[model samples]
Target: MNHPNMKKDQPVTLQTFKKGDKYHHKIVVEEAGYINDVIFRLGRETPGSYNGQQITVNYEEQGGALVGTVKYPAHNKVIHNTYEMDGQNLAKTSECEGVVHKRWYNKQQN
Candidate 1:
């Protein structure tokens, strides 16, 4: 999620904070209105920029977490992700290449 006022071409840094570093984080979806579901991916680059990257997904409920697989045929690489909501936050564990990446996202309050 990003600030709605931010332009698509705006530069943004996506990094994890160090264990001892203090930081504030939130994923905001402002004026989202009504939707049937919320599905997204987290990466250094937008998912659309990946050539030959095929994505398949399904969800168990409306506006709920998703389970999906992202495959990069060009590199023979694949990432599998399973998502769930923990309390008010979003949590996911991704198996990419040979590494496991765990991510959590806090929902922003209005």
Candidate 2:
């Protein structure tokens, strides 16, 4: 039951930080090891000091290689995508945005 899909020769490690002006964000998702779905609330706003922040995620792996964490003070690492899976089962995604092996089923229902 998952649909909002995206996959294609995956590999994404995005980073943005600008304190003085504006711009702050983080989206980390590693592959074949760990570190899945780690993100920061915001990274760029200029309308009302943009107030909405809540991000917490931690992970570690040595053998397969995938590590990402966030505890406030500082520490954010996990950006690498190179996908090559397939799709079926009503929206099973993972052609490359990292690992998502067989777990999707959205039969278009509202």
Candidate 2 displacement at residue 11 in angstroms: 4.2
Q: Tens digits of per-residue lDDT for model 1 on 1-110? A: 33456565543322222234222122233343211222333322223322224433322322555555655656677777776789976677799867998877666554
Report the lDDT tens digits of candidate 2 across residue range 1-110. Answer: 11134345444343334466433443333442222233232321112111132334333333432233333323232223221223522322232235444333323233
Task: Give candidate 1 regions above 4 Å deviation.
Answer: 1-48, 51-64
Superposition error at 97 for model 1 (Å): 3.4
Local accuracy by lDDT, each model:
0.47, 0.32
TM-score of each candidate structure, all chains considered together: 0.45, 0.20
Q: What does the lDDT come to for candidate 1?
A: 0.47
How far residue 109's Cα lies from its native spot in candidate 2, in Å, is 43
User: Whose lDDT is greatest here?
Assistant: 1
lDDT comparing candidate 2 with the true structure: 0.32
Which runs in model 2 stand beyond 4 Å of their true positions? 1-4, 11-13, 21-23, 28-54, 57-68, 71-110
